[model samples]
Target: MKVINHIREVRQRKGITQIKLAEDLQVTRQTINAIEKNKYNPSLELSLKLAEYLDVPFTSLFYLDKSEENAE
Candidate 1:
């Protein structure tokens, strides 16, 4: 199983820069970068905040993957 975050895609689609997102989230750009790279997992509160900021559902930003599902 792998944890995947679609932050980069969502941000791009929303035309939002990492720095801007960081500022809105009150986090560092590095933290946003880490989350985008899957190097860090945000807390539930942060996740909800991100969803709100991006105008996306929480699941649209993050998801769980199964090996079998990924293979398809």
Candidate 2:
């Protein structure tokens, strides 16, 4: 499934860099980069934490591709 996220845009709007966000999450900048690039999927707990950190609702932050749903 495609892990679509608005994190990059939102983070940019919030004036937060990947390095800063990673520090807040106690992870590495590469980890945040992976998530933003869709090379990695964060755990459910991490997803929630991300939403909390970005001040956005979870549903707003992450979503599965509707095309994937149609394939099911």
Candidate 3:
């Protein structure tokens, strides 16, 4: 099953621009874009840092879809 995330939603809700978040994380805007679009999954360290940066719980940011898992 694919792992999807609500990173974009949370980022938007906080009014944080991709560039701003990238700058804060010392990553490229393209990297942020990739993450938001689910084309890339951040590392465990980065994930924790992102959750901290967004002021949210890690669990709330990502989850596995049972539907996707069961579809097979």
Candidate 4:
């Protein structure tokens, strides 16, 4: 299953910049960019941190795309 996230949308709506978020989360801006672009899946700890920092529920920020789970 693929991981999908609303990190960018929520961040933008909340007027948070990637750099600021990364700094606040103690991560690199590239890491945030990668996650936002769906090029990387964050660690569980980071994921929780993101949700907390973004002021959103974990389920609201991230989910699995199971549509392809049974495709094989």
Candidate 5:
């Protein structure tokens, strides 16, 4: 299964910058970038924190893709 996220879209929509989000979350901007690029998967604690910080539901921010092919 692949983990997909709408973090960039939601964050952009909310006018939140990667640096700002990272600072608020006590993480590095590279961490946010990697997560946005699908190069990293956040831990459960961080996932919950992201949802809470973005004021979005967990399902709205992240989901699973069961297909074998790449999402793109």
Candidate 6:
């Protein structure tokens, strides 16, 4: 399975920078970058914190699929 994260787009829509989001979530900018790139999946607590910070539903931030080609 593959997971996709819409963090960058959401942050852009909210007019927030990655640094700002990282600060709000108490994580590093690299962590946010990794999440956006699908290189790292956030923990449950981190996912909830991101959802709260972005003011979006958890489903809006992340998605799961069975195919790598269809994941994006």
Instruction: Please give the lDDT score at residue 62 for candidate 4.
Output: 95
Per-residue C-alpha lDDT of model 4 across residues 1-72, encoded as one tens digit per residue: 899999999999999999999999999999999999999999999999999998899999999988898787
Evaluated against the true structure, the overall lDDT of model 1 is 0.90
3-55, model 1: which lDDT tens digit per residue?
78898998998899999999999999999999999988888998899999998
Query: What are the per-model numbers of colliding residue pairs?
Result: 0, 0, 0, 0, 0, 0
User: lDDT for every model?
Assistant: 0.90, 0.93, 0.90, 0.95, 0.94, 0.89
Query: Could you tell me how far off, in angstroms, the CA of residue 44 lies in candidate 2 after the best superposition?
Result: 0.9
Model 2, 1-72: lDDT tens digits are 788999999999999999999999998999999999988999988899999999999998998878977989
Candidate 5 per-residue lDDT, tens place, 1-72, comes to 889999999999999999999999999999999999988999999999999999999998999876756754
TM-scores of the candidates are 0.87, 0.90, 0.93, 0.92, 0.91, 0.88
TM-score of 2: 0.90
| By lDDT: ranked, best first | 4, 5, 2, 1, 3, 6
TM-score of 3: 0.93
Clashing pairs in 5: none
- Tell me the alpha-carbon RMSD of every candidate: 2.4, 1.5, 0.9, 1.1, 2.6, 2.8
Candidate 6 lDDT, 1-72, residue by residue in tens: 778889899999989998998898889999999998999989999999898888999997888865866755
lDDT of 2: 0.93
Which TM-score value belongs to model 6? 0.88
